[model samples]
Target: MKPIYSRIVATGGYLPERILSNRDLEQMVETSDAWIFARTGIRSRHIAAPGEKTVDMAEAAARQALADAGLNAADLDLIIVATTTPDQIFPSTACLLQARLGNRGAPAFDIQAVCTGFIYALATADRFIRSGGARHALVVGVESMSHIVDWTDRGTCILFGDGAGAVVLSAGDQPGIISTHIHADGAYADLLQVPGGETRIAMQGNAVFRVAVRTLGEIVQETLAANALTPAEIDWLVPHQANIRIIEATADKLGLPMERVVTTVEHHGNTSAASVPLALDEAARRGCFQPRQRLLLEAFGGGFTWGSALLRWG
Candidate 1:
C-alpha cells in the first residue's frame, strides 16, 4: 500500500471591513502612530462589524476555500476550527460553521492554542489523511480578538484584529506536508493570558517578545533540520503576525532576506490563529508561490505554544 499525504488544495482568507488605524488608536488610547508603528510594525487592523461572529468569518473563508478547491461541503470528511474566541461555549465554532455550510456527519471540532492553533489543526488534519481517516479536510483559523480586547488598554487593544483563513486539504500520493513540529510549555502562560471570566488580554510585551524570538528561532532551526533542508531551499516563510521584531529575528536566523517572508502584520495586526493562514492566502493570491516550492509556516502563541510546518506548494 502506498502512503497518503495531505496536500493543500486551496486557501481563502477574510478580514472585516472596518479599519482601525494607528491614528485611530491614538484617539482610543494614549498611543501615537509613530510609537505603535515603530514598535509593532502595524499600521492598521480590521474590526468586525457589530454582531459579526467568529463562525460568520469562518463560514466566509471556508466557502471561498471550498470554491477554490472546487469541492462541495459534502465532500469534506473532517472539519477543524482553530479559534481563541469561539462564538459559544457549548457548540464548538467548527460545529456552528459546519451547520452553516450544510456539511453533515463530518466530525467537526475546535482547537485552542491561541496563535498557534492553525498550524496545530493542520498537523492533525494531515495525520487523519495519512492514517486513512479522511480524504477531504477543511481547516480554518478565525478570530474576533476585539471581542475580548480591552478597548482602553494601550497594550493589547492596538495589537489585534478580527479575521479568518481557511484551507482545503485533500489526500494525495506525493508529499503534501513534508514535516510538522509542535510544542508547548505552560510555565510561560502568565506572560500572556486572559482570565476566564474577564474580557481582557494581559501580556507582558517585552518579555513575550524576547521569548517569541528565541522559541521561534529554535523552531525554525528544528524544522529545517527535521526535513534535512537548508535555508536556501526555502522559498517563503509564512509566520505568525504577532510582532514585527519576532518575524524579523526568525528570518534573519534562517539567512533569508526579508523579501522572502510573507508579512501582513502591517495591516492585519495579529489575528491570533488567523495570522499565518491569512498571510499564506494573501501571498498565494499574489502569485508569490510556485508549485513544488518549499514554504515554511510557523507560529508562537499564548499558552506558550509554538510550532512549524514545512510543505511543498501543491
Candidate 2:
C-alpha cells in the first residue's frame, strides 16, 4: 500500500471591517504612528464590531474555504479550530463552527498553542489523514484578540488584531505537507502572556524578541535539514504575522528575499493563531503560489510555543 498525504485543497480568510490605525492608537494612548511603525511595522489592523465574535469570523473563513474547494460541510471527516478567544467555555469553537456549517459528528475540537496553533492543527489533520482516520479535514485559525487587548497598554494593544483564516485538506497519493515541527517551553510563558486574573495582554517585549529570534532561526534550520533541502529551495516564507523584526530574521535564515515572504503584519498585526493562515490565504488569493513550488510556514507565540510546516503548492 502506498502512503497517504494530506493536501491543501483550498484556503480562506476574513477580517473585520472596522479599521484601527496607529493614528487612532495615538489618540487612545501616548504613542505616535511613526514610533509604532518603526518598532512593529504595523500601520493598522481590523477590529471586530461589538456584535462580532470569534465563531462568526471562523464561519466566514470556513465557508469561503469550503466554497473555494468545491466541498460541502458534510464532506469533512474532521473539524479543528485553533483559537484563543472562543465564544464559549463549555463548547469548543470547533463544535460551534461545525454546527454553523451544519457538519454533524466529525469529531470537532480546538487546539490552543497561541500563534503556533494553526501549524499544530494542520499537522494533526495531516497525521489523521495519513492514518486513514479521515479523508478530509477543515482546519481553522481564528482569534478575537481585540476583545482581550488592553486599550490603554500600548505595548501589547498595538501588536494584536482580530481575524480568522481557514484551509480545506484532502488525502492524496503525493505529499502536500512535506513536514511539520512544533515545540513549546512553558518556562518562558510569563515573558508574554495575559496574566491569570487579567483579560489584557502583558509582555516583556525585549525578552520575548530575543527568544523568538533564536528559536525561529533554529527551527528554520531544523525544517530544512529534515527535508534535506536548503534555504534557497524555499519559494516562499508564509510566517506568523507578528513583529517585523522576527519575520525578517526568519527570512534572513532562509536567505529568501523580502518579496518572497508573505507579510501582513503592517495591516493585520498579530492575529495569534490566525496569522499564518491569514497570510497564506491572502497570498494564495493573489495567485502568488505556483504548482510544485515549496513554501515554508512558521510561527512563534506565547507558551514560548513555536512551529514550522513545509509544503508544496499544487
Candidate 3:
C-alpha cells in the first residue's frame, strides 16, 4: 500500500480594503517613506476595518480556498488556524472559523507559533493526514496585526499589517508536502513579541533581524537535506513576507535569485502568520506556479519561532 501524503489542492488569500501607505504612517508616526521602504521593503499595507475580526478574514480566505479546491466545508476532516491575535482568548480562532464555514466535529484548533504559525499548522495537518486521522484539512493563517501595533511606536508600528491566507490539503498517493522543519528558542522570545494580555507589540529589531536571517537559512538547508534535494532544485521560494532583506538573504543562501522568490511585503508588509500563504496564493493566482514544480516555503516570527516546508506544487 502506498503512503498517504497531504498535498495542497488549492490556495486563497484575503486582504482588507483599507490601505495604509508609508506616507500615511509619516502623518501618524515620526518616519519617512524612504526609511520604511529602505529597511523593510514595505510601502503600503492593508488595515482591517473596525470590527473586522481575525475569524472574518480567515473565513473569507478559507471559503476561497474551498472553492478553488472544488471542495466544501463538509469535506474537511480537520481545521487548523494559526494566529496570535485571535478575536478572543476563550474560543480558539479555529472554532470560530469552523462555525463561520459551517464545519463541525472535525477537530478544529489553533496554533500560536506567531509568524511561523502557518508552517506549524501545515505540518500538524500533514501529520493527521499521514496518520490516517484525516483526509482533507483546511489550514489557515490569519491575523489582525494592525490592532496590536502601537501606533505611537514608530519602530514596530510601521512593520505590520492585516490579512489572511489559506490552503486546502487533501490525502493523495503522490508526494505533496515533501518535508517540514520547525525550530524555536524561547530565550529569544523577547526579541519579538507582544506582552501577555496587551494589544501593543514590541521588538528588538536588530536582534531579531540577525537571528531570523541565520536561523531561516539553516532551516531551509535542513528541509532540503531531509528531502534529499538542494536549493538549486527548488523552482520557487515562497518565503515569509517579513522583510524584503530577510527574504533576499534567505534566497541568497539558497543560491537562488530574487526573481525566484514570491514576495508581497512591498504591498502587504508583514501580515504575521498570514504572510507565507498570502504570498503563495498571490503567486498561484497569477499563474506563477506550474503543476509538480518544487516549491520551498519558510517563515520566522515572534516566538523566536521559524520553520520551512518543501512541497510539490499542484
Candidate 4:
C-alpha cells in the first residue's frame, strides 16, 4: 500500500511591533532582566499594540503563507487556528481570520489546547487530508497572551510574549508525518491555567514545570518508538519555546545536542500556541531545515495538554 503525505508547502509568521524587552518589563513590574533571562531565556518579546487582535495577526500570517504557497485566499479549503486567546469568545479566531482574508464559506474554527494547540490542529488537518476531505488547508497557531497576562505578576508576566505562525499544508502522496502522540491530564489542569475571564493566567509554576519536562520527554520517546526512528535520525528537535531549561532537558533526555534544537525563546518568549510554528518558520528562514529532513515537534502547556509529531520536513 502506498503512503499518503500531508506536505507543508509554505510557512509564515507575524510578530507585533511593540517590542518589550526584559528591561522594559522591569518598569511595568518588579522583575529583573537577569532573573527572566536566567529562568526563561526571554530577552525580548513582541507586544501587540492596542487594536491589534489575534484575528489580525492570524490574517497577516495566513496572507504570507498563502503568498509563499503561490495560492490565493480563495484557494484554501479549510482554516484551522490553534489559539487560546481569541478576538472574541464566540466567533472562533479561525472564522474571523477567514472573513478577514476574504475567504468565504470554507470551514473555519479554532482549536484550544493551550500550548499544544498547533500540534493538535496539525494532527487534525493531517487526518482530514489523509481522508481526502480537504486538498488545501491553513493551520495557524496564534496568541495574544499580553491581553490576558497580569502585568503585576512578575513570574508569569515575564515568561510570555505575543505572535502568530502559520503553514500551508496540501495533500500529496509521500512521507510527511511519520508518527504522532497526544496526551492530557485534566487533573493537573489547574497547575497551569487561567482562572477568570475564560480563566486568567493562573498557575502553580513549580507543578507545571515538573509536568512539562517529564511529559515532554515521554512523548519524544513515544514518537521515536512509533516511527522506529532513533534520536540520531532527527535533524531538528523543535520543542515548545516556553523556557530554555525545558528545551535543554528534553534534548538531554533524547540524547540530542543543544545545537540541533530549534529555539526562539530568547526573543519570542512563550507565544503559547504560536511558539511551534513560529520557531519552525524562523528555522526555515535561516535555511536550517532542509527538504526531507526529519523533524520532531513537541509541546506542553495549559489544560495540562502535551503532544508530539514526527515529520519529514519539506
Give the alpha carbon lDDT tens digit for every residue of 10-125 in model 2.
99999999999999998899999999999999999999999899999999999999999999999999999999899889599999999999998799999999999999999999
**Tens-place lDDT digits, model 4, residues 37-148:** 9988889999999999998898888888999999998998889999999988888899888888999988998999999999999999888888888889999999999998
Across residues 1-314, which tens digit of lDDT does each residue of candidate 1 receive? Answer: 99999999999999999999999988889999999889999999999999999999999999999999999999999999999999899699999999999999999999999999999999999999999999999999999999989999998888999999999999999997999999999999999999777879999999999999999999999998888889999999999998898899999999999999999999999999999989999999999999999999999999899999999997
In candidate 4, how many Å is residue 89 off? 1.5
Q: What is the Cα-based TM-score of model 4?
A: 0.97
What clash pairs does model 4 have? 194-199, 194-200, 195-200, 196-199, 196-200
Q: Assess each prediction's global lDDT (C-alpha) against the native.
A: 0.95, 0.94, 0.94, 0.90
Candidates by lDDT, descending order? 1, 2, 3, 4
Clash totals, every prediction: 0, 0, 0, 5
Model 4 CA lDDT for position 188? 89
lDDT of 4: 0.90
By TM-score, the better pick of 3 and 4 is: 3
Residues 1-314 of candidate 3: C-alpha lDDT, one tens digit per residue:
88999999999899999999999999998999999999999999999999999999999999999999999899899999999889998699999889998987899999999999999999999999999999999999999998888999999989999999999999999999999888888999777878887779989999999999999989988988888887789999999999999999999999998888999999999999999999999999999999999999999998789998899999
RMSD of each: 0.6, 0.6, 0.8, 1.2
